[model samples]
Target: MDFKNEKQGAFMVVVPAGRMDAVTAPEFEQECERLIQSGELKMVADMSALEYISSAGLRSILATAKKLKGQQGEIRFCGLEGMVEEVFSISGFSSMFPVFDTRDDAIKD
Candidate 1:
């Protein structure tokens, strides 16, 4: 996955393209960790270009969300489509986390 990091108001946006599977999940997780360490807990993952996500990817997101929750912040997902959105919904993550139609929507939250 190729990630483009951006700062929007109180949130840090990570726009990752391509597939976020086992191989790339760790890198994405590290990015989240970096944001957290930098005291940027409000995260918005702009997954508009992400084509796929496996169990490892879901785990990484869950871990990040948990971390943010502890810091009194959040991790919102946006621009999900196709199988990626399906997987998240089927896996019950839709209720576990907040999802938006655009990065701007997430940022506004």
Candidate 2:
């Protein structure tokens, strides 16, 4: 996965492209950690560019959420489509966190 980040108001918008699987899951975690350490407590994950995701990716996201929770931080999602959206919905991730249509909508909260 190729991850990119942009700061928008109080949130960091995370864009992950390509595929997210076991090999790249750690990279995602590391990036989230780095963001957290940098004092970014609010995040919006824009998954529109992501073509694929696996259980490892889900685990990484869960782990990231835990990290943010302890610091009173939060993670939300936007631009989810195709199988990625299905996975989130089937796995009940949709209810676990806020899912928006765009970064702007997500950061509004």
Candidate 3:
């Protein structure tokens, strides 16, 4: 997976592309850790370009979310579709996290 991070007001927008599996989950978690350590609390994960996600990927995201929550931070996800969306739904992550249909919507709050 490839992550592109951008600053938008008080939120950090993270755009991840490609497959997020065991091979890439650690990198994704590390990136989230870096953001938190750097004082980036509010984040929006724009998954529009993401093609696939595995259980490891979900675990990484859950870990990040828990860490962020402990710091009173938040993570929102947007633009999920296809197998990626299915994974989130089947994993119950769709209800666990804030999901939006668009990046713009995710950042609106």
lDDT of 2 at 30: 93
Candidate 1 per-residue lDDT over residues 1-109, each given as its tens digit: 7889999998999888888899999988988998899999888998888999999999989888888899998889999899999999999998888899888889894
lDDT of each: 0.90, 0.93, 0.92
Return whichever of 2 and 3 wins on TM-score: 2
Q: Candidate 1 or 2, higher TM-score?
A: 2
Candidate 2 error regions (>4 Å):
none
lDDT of 3 by residue, 1-109 (tens): 6889999878899888898999998988999999999999999998888898999999999999999999999999999999999999988999999999988888887
Give candidate 3's whole-model lDDT: 0.92
Candidate 1 lDDT score at position 37 = 97
lDDT of 2 by residue, 1-109 (tens): 6888899888999998889999998999999999999999999999999989999999999999999999999999999999999999999999999999877799895
lDDT of 2 at 10: 85
In candidate 2, what residue range of length 10 has the lowest lDDT sum? Answer: 100-109
- What lDDT does candidate 1 reach at residue 99? 94
